[model samples]
Target: MTVVTKPKAQPRAFISLRSSVDFVVTSTTSEIIDRALGYLRAGFPVHFRGPAGTGKTTLALHIAAQLDRPVMLMVGDEQLTSSDLVGEQNGYRYRRVVDRYIHSVVKYEEDAVQNWVDNRLTTACREGFTLVYDEFTRSRPEANNVLLAALEERVLVLPTSNGANAYVKVHPDFRAIFTSNPQEYAGVHDAPDALSDRLVTMDLDYYDRPTEISITASNSGLDLAEVERVVDIVREFRDSGEYDQAPTLRACIMIARVSALQGIRPSLGDKRFVQICLDVLESKTAYTSKNRDRRTAQRKMLVQMIDHHMAHPLDAERV
Candidate 1:
């Protein structure tokens, strides 16, 4: 029952989606974006659920930015607690005074008080800031209980016993968006049913090839053809059903960015380029079949894919 206080975080860390400015809105992703925005505008909390690298967190931030309110971001993890969310008495402040002047003067005074610090949730709720709770499922359900009332009743009950108001009225402008991967993923807990019921959950998968190509090209500053080649190579492995978790757009960006920066072409003949792709991608391939050696099979597949793409460079215009 002890309150644990962590240092105050910069307000911008929770709400600012600075990277969202460059987020691509292509034909494939537009519908998802529009739907999420619609739900948020309707005063409903939107939850973007998907696999890692699907850009769930990014999309959540984009939606939060669309609200045009001060932003607050809260990361969820196993050790998170209600105190962590709603704020706690950070510590105490003390002061002592001594008086000595007159011939017989002798006086002393002392004062001590708990220092109350508002957490991200409390500050955002009170100020009506848009909150993006990323990877919320990583936090235990009990830790997130504080959000039930905030989401349902628009009130936040403070957990301190320092004799202050027990609850806060949520600001009318307050809105929240949450992002998480599937429950099957490791280290993620099931969301409380009651809390889940209050949200409009949207499932996000990998972006279509063109959308991904655009994202990679824009973010990595690589030639469109090079980006497309990498994207195609990744897509082949992903769709081949060889891995439980496919490399995502993030992998494409990494490969593209490194290649562009290092002046390494995305080709099988280039040892560094091949190594970069394998390092960034090979571990994600599940390689679960008992029939073959996973490590060897995975390496071979990657090498062949790279060689194929290199020999037959994608037609940038057609792509």
Candidate 2:
């Protein structure tokens, strides 16, 4: 007779997310984050709901970091499923044993069994890791049905085939953060009311002008005055409702950074600077009408916007 010991399997590495160091935390941003943290620490999951460029996903990661736990990040997809959330039987694990009763004779036995793997959600629940599910509504609602009980009952019901461990007791330190675009946005699916009832949703809008300018200045390596000029034009364009898509703070930063790198000032006096502003802002509308000259009209409007903010040399003196 022979005896053997199974070696221990090493634990898999937990997922790591890069720090949100570049995330500009202004007064308004701080307030939103604090409120979301309050909800999360109180044993309720937090949801940041807003349109595109509203920083929902970024805010979710920021809040998850404050929980002081290892984080698991999940990007929602249309192909996700309940098994994808919990555990599923994968290929198989095989074992072989050889017995030598006498010097002249030997016998062999082999066994194989299905391997089960825990997906991100299940691992987060069992190990008490913070979960950041970005663009969760992009996943089909049926795929997310597994979350209902986990959020409400503090228990995760697993498939019976998982055998003795058919359910996971939600860890006391477990927390989940979710982000999603508005239901009207393309490729965004409507979340179920049952799941929505479990979350404390915070609807985010674009940062106010002061915050936008501050963020642009920090990210673009541009002076406050220059950033203000760029942000002002973008904000004006956003408010005018003259385009297919609204311009965002991202647009402001894009213009500011490129101009700064190229040694172009944000001034109407410089033709290159004027062209940069038009190029960054004009792409939003993309007019292709042969009948009417929408491009000419919008170009005229955008130039007027730039002239309002950057044409004045005195604006620099005030800054």
- Kindly list the per-residue Cα lDDT of model 1 for residues 252-310, writing each as its tens digit: 99999999999977755679988988887887865556735876887899888888888
lDDT of each: 0.84, 0.86
In model 1, which runs have C-alpha deviations exceeding 4 angstroms? 1-15, 20-22, 93-111, 162-164, 268-271, 286-292, 314-319
Looking at model 2, which ten-residue stretch has the lowest summed lDDT?
1-10
Model 2, 208-253: lDDT tens digits are: 9999998888878888888888998999999999988889888998
The candidate maximizing lDDT is 2
RMSD of 1: 5.5
Q: Each prediction's TM-score against the native?
A: 0.85, 0.91
User: lDDT of candidate 1 vs native?
Assistant: 0.84
Residue 268 lDDT (model 2): 67
Model 2: residues with Cα > 4 Å off, grouped in runs: 1-21, 102-108, 286-292, 314-319
lDDT of 1 at 317: 30
